[model samples]
Target: MEKNELGMTHKKKEFSEWYPELLIRSEFIDYSLVSGAIVFRPSAYFAWEIIKDYVDKEFKKIGIENVYFPLFIPESLLLKEAEHFEGFSPEVAWVTHAGKSELSERLAVRPTSETIMYYSYAKWIRSWRDLPLRYNQWNNVVRWEFKNPTPFIRTREFLWNEGHSVFASEQEARAERDQILGIYLKALRELTCLYGIVGKKTDYEKFAGAVESYSIELVMPDGWCVQGPDFHYDGQNFSKAFDIKFINKESKEEYAYQNTYAISTRVLGVMVATHSDDKGLVLPPKLAQKQVVIVPIPARSEDIDKKLQDYSEKVLNTLKEHGLRAFIDNRDNYTPGYKFNEWELKGVPFRLEIGKKELESNTVVIAIRDTSEKKGVSLDKLIEAIDNEIEAMHNRLYENSKRMVQSFIHNIESYDELKKNIANGGIYHAPWCGSTDCEIKIKQETGAKITNIPLDQSDLHGRCIYCNKEARYMANFARSY
Candidate 1:
């Protein structure tokens, strides 16, 4: 079957099935030999590279250095922190044997590098000079998840950049936490024009060892929520547990404050789900590998073909001169329709069509993948026209997704409305009394989980939505991916 004609399930019709199938059929990822792992294809990995480059440059600008930590953590070290160990123990993958020998103490595959990194920091940090050590690592980490693996969303192993930092003062650590989250927000905006709601996760949803946690939640096309750019203020929890102490300039010893921020490859998943449509992927211009693809419609005569070929090259070179990624699609075999489908499916942001008439008129036909809008542009205005299309496409996507998110969020004051909204696949925001029993009761009645508690805010509503008692916090609840 033709790539576009394949009997694929429509994403809106059956999002659960279509999401995975799109990942496979689009050649973004493939099932690995290992049951729960996936092989990331060039298209997906290229998007990841774009994200990595953007995030890495931001980190460097802020004086954070990249470093590598071991993939395996000793069992003792992994279990050093009581709450953290308990939290991750179920999902921790263990390395029990080595070279046909049974190890005395099985090592745990690094679900996260917190326990191991903090353990090392204890010894390396001796004075206040080493107090604010910031390190980030880009690598794959494993957690033996029992659920089915969804390529970028949930998997036994996935690639991510984890930022770990230690500071002598809580104020410094808090500032670092917020700064990194802001960087993530900026990177998302720069790359995908995606905006996220910034808030703090509730006690039940916070990280394993964090004292307080903040998150940026992105609303997906399906009305589900994906947590992005999580920042955890450790408040000397790990530092104290692991004895990560340093001598202050005042000759006093104190525990170091820790902060960590992480944005996973999962954000790529969010990008694909949010922007892509029934046709195929709809990539943001900044992240697309081929921003503009030049296709020359074949002419009957060899002389015409030669002119078209030369014209296509000229257009490609002009785009390159203007700092846009451009390529000439000069395959002699494939039809123009096929080329269009392939490029659209691949999510090229812009397509420049050079033909006999266009070459004679000193114009090129521009087709944008995001909106499927086509227009003829003079060669003189080609660069400016292309840039304008990209900006408009990004704005179109941002606004569309923003509208979807705003519509999905329902502020419910009544219990029945909360249940009905959540059952109908809406993210519900309601005031709560801040009791664990109330939170659990809501979960038991509705399948939705409390996602975030808006941070640094005063009281919004007068009374609790659920219990009629005085409200403690305004909690945002949603069914997450």
Candidate 2:
């Protein structure tokens, strides 16, 4: 098909415009009639499935089980936790009427399932035997955002997997929280080849009801940061709110410590923005729906076609036997060059091109999507080359991203420096005296917000950027999405 023209600008000129257009072009997602919502087409949904399957397997290995919860939470239950409710009320979507009749108590589409899930936990856990309830849900949530929404990034509704857990003590809860964060970090690195800064979000940036929160922030190609995954230590926040209590081995009753964490499809958007080029998406091989695409070049006589088809089957079986996601693009109408670009846009990791000449030589030509590297490999050593290419591509993606991340951070020791950095558009690292007034002052002056208070707390020798008071902590300040 000739390239369809839509309302999108060229990819090279405007990345922001290109993103939405490419999504539609790739059959990933599309806009819906409702404002701030989009429909996930097969391609995007399949990618999400790949991520979910791998992540779910990892969670299961760590003793977490999948579970589903109700979509509508009682207004009373959502409001039970006053602080949580206050934090969420501004963005909550309420259902006041059921069909034709108005209900006495309004219901809420879950902004998050913590309140509703914990209410059930309170009923289920009566003793220490039920101390650690490790459950996760693959579901969607709604939040009414006033700002303009980007697909996957800040939509009113989106898909995400939320993990909630309860433990007998603070120590166990904290450990689990960090453990989950570690898993998320590893998954991002392994599957997407994306690196991130692992640190704690500042009080203002922390999750609404969390006592403490940590996040992995992946840097996109344009130097903007995207939150990869997040972990929250609920502490007694949810337990006290929901009265989730249990009896100890000695028969004494106590509140259970808790934690909740989530990774969303927004992460897929981050990956696409980070790795994809003007041509199209350059998906990491591990996460690609189809890692290796085999295209037979040059039409041959029926007798030759039969022989080549037999050989192609052997190659496909070999790659599959080695556990690679491989596919054969057997359509006869398109030229080999057309198939090459199509697969490149789709970000298939390795493309194997075979023809009579190469078949006679007992070899195939391999092209990599990431680096556009090409080489000829003997059929016997194809699997080995494929393995090497995947590793090399991941290393390249990580190195390039790490370099871009370094460019986006500016170390600031004074208010003037903060102003300059903010104007230039990047994250500024500055010292703060741990005062709300000073933080607010900096924002009023620079239009920047405190994004993170790193757990690896480092004492700054310099004074606070705003009040010139004794600084306590080094904070990452930025203009966030």
Candidate 3:
């Protein structure tokens, strides 16, 4: 086999090296000319589109309308909310000049759309009838992160849905949290085939200017935690800052309760890291660009070669007619083994081998990507078999993710245990008194910050791990990506 067809140079266990190798070698994504930015190849982009479309459809069902905002926000608008501006200032990229001349007011490449979107919200909203303004935008934002960039994870520029919602009361605003989080969770499970810990953020760890924040936390294969989709209850912070007021039924002006939530390309990174292996990418069947690849293994004889080619096309059409993304590799230069290795590296969920034997028997040998399982299915039963295989592969990946995440969660009773176990990357589930002092000390001493306080607060009986004060909510602490 050629060096290019031999698969990844680094093993999945050597994650630091293996990750980029797999993604690049498999042609999933590529490093861009600009630093901290990446070009998502067809496979990666297709996966994101699947995720984005799924979430968008769900959003529309729940009355969230899609809208687009300008890529740049005026510096004055960003500074309207002091805390929001402060949180993003370090990462914000500025556009001080247009072509050659300096602009009077500098424009910030949007780190988040809260300021820009809310500015319009204040103008559009006027009465109680416009109580709930649930608007979301699918856009790209530039953060210009100083830390070392990871493709899809911590890039300088990334794409996401910035869902900004306005409601009449705090109750209405807070209620939207679960609905949005549920959509994200469903996308992770059904499309990404992954699991996450749904939890509330600590005050110190919450989104800047949010009254309270919630997140879906996912753990990587390396055992480090990375946050997934998140929802924030902003209360009246942005409404007050931007003056998004509405007249109530009693003819009184009141600030709108607000919430913001997002699911980003970062989760795509988590999905890739969690499910992929040394062979190459291991994409879920639903998210694969080409779910099935039919490779015709010709016997060199003219008669057999023609038969294999015709049979492969028939199988491709059959799968496609049944709504499967299928393709045929009938290239003359490459051998069957080479094609198999190449497709496997590219992470096609299923490979159909149609050769002389399959042509004679009217069957194709299906190769499952994730498990490397092979079985021959008759042409008539091929579609059903592929559907079953897709479901099975999705379930297996999801289960694996669930099991791995569960294993990383450790219930600790003492601070000593936390300090000892913190080095081995995983979430340390320990008691907290809700003090920033303890949160800071734990991070400083052990390098583990609070990931979140899980919604499931059962068995909340223990002393604070650090200060030994009465425990409040149980928090998950981990060294994150």
Candidate 4:
């Protein structure tokens, strides 16, 4: 009698059940004592570390230096920006007392860091040279979300990086916003093989105090078009509130143009939802903590078991020497069947199965998790084969995810058609006039909101999806998580 990990129920028949069940059973995350937060298990935290390490390097290259800021913001400073404060006030966690004494003013656990950071920026920046202040912070933010908490998605507190920058001119500020967003988009593809559509948020849906905002929308297994990561163009919004002004080249004191963006742990959720299947998790090699796992198959005879272990050790060393993250499963108590199921459930990008037939043939079986394809490779060429297989697996995951995301998109031409298909999940691309009232009506009629307005929009001369008014842009509509 052994306590083995549990496999998830059928994902297709019961996705909501399957999703959270696998996350907990796989030891990725656990529901914490805290009502709305989670303790990331070692397995899940390591994956997040891999992403942070890569992104941290990227930020350094672009001259965006990292620094830490106090987690609590005084109520007075938080309310300096009325819109930003109002938007997050409901969810803000306030500290009104210290031990037993009442505090003079409440301090808010930061829902976002704009107000606090900009207040310091005002004192730090004195002239034109200080104009391009590019600073980044990797920290936790508290929002006290009330909705059902999902691991790595909706939580009261989450790990996220907020990159704030200042520029002397409008052009520089705008360009930097787009450039930083490009970095995040690249991070998604290279890190997780997740595909998404980049679009501008409507005025109503844009960041509370941002001049403009954009999001990358992906279709989950349940067909909801959810946003994982997003960026904002602050455009002197916070600078004005906090008086972050500097002397210009022309010797004029002016407010600095600014921008801030946040990419959170929720991205890992998107990767899991998009790529994992009925069998178990299917991880992208780049972010997988243990990229490759080799399981040694013990023979019935003692002599054969000894030979297999020796060979498996050599194979494990070879893979490690090639700069691969790998592990060898040589635990005697577990059967080979148990090992296979265990690694597959963990989503190791590739697995090595070594046995007697392969030893005589001088070959080893390679299992590709993403495609569930197994092949035999010559022992002499094992390193080269694994490298190539890993690359192929990454490409396949990206292509398959891209295809699925494209399949969920339906272009709507009629309001009745929208109502008929609202329940059927997916992103509906439809023409709409730029009107908040029209947008509200659409939400009332259909639960879906206009998530984004695509950057490269189609010609817009038709009637709005709701009001029959002139269509201004092709907006993405979906019921989101």
Task: Please provide TM-scores, in order, for all candidate models, with all chains considered together.
Answer: 0.96, 0.93, 0.98, 0.97
Worst 10 residues of 3 by lDDT: 1-10
Q: Give the number of colliding residue pairs in candidate 2.
A: 0
Error of 4 at 129 (Å): 1.4
Tens-place lDDT per residue, model 4, 1-481, is: 3424356655744877878877876677888889878888876888788788877888899899998899889999998989998899999999999999999999999998998898899999999987689999999999988888777767888998999999998898888867777878888888778888899999988888999998988777777877767888888888888898999988899999988887888888878877888777888887788888888787798999889988888888898999999989988888888877777777888989999998778789998887778999998899899888878878888888899888988888778878888797888888898999988888887898988887888555577978888888889888887
What is candidate 1's CA lDDT for residue 135? 91
Candidate 1 local lDDT, 305-422, one digit each (tens): 9988888888888889888889988887788888888887777888888888998999999998877889999999998898888888888877776777788888877778887777
lDDT rank, highest first?
Answer: 3, 4, 1, 2
TM-score of 2: 0.93
Write the number of the candidate with greater lDDT, choosing between 2 and 3. 3
Per-residue lDDT tens digits of candidate 2, residues 1-481?
Answer: 5332322245734767878776766566789998889998776777788788878999999999999999999999998888789889999999999789999998999999999999899999899998689999999999999998888888999888999999999999998866788788877888777777778877767788899889887665555566778999989988988899999888999999988999998888877777877767678777777889998876558877776777788899999999999988988877777788787777787899888877788888998887787899999999899999989998887677677677888888888887865755677778888888888777777778777776676556688888889888888787766
Candidate 1 worst ten-residue window by lDDT? 3-12
Error of 2 at 23 (Å): 2.0
Candidate 3, 238-293: lDDT as tens digits: 99999999999989999999999999999889898888887888999999999999
* Residue pairs clashing, model 3: none
Q: Model 2 off-target regions past 4 Å?
A: 2-9, 299-310
Per-residue lDDT for 97 in model 1?
96
- Give the better candidate number (1 or 2) by TM-score: 1
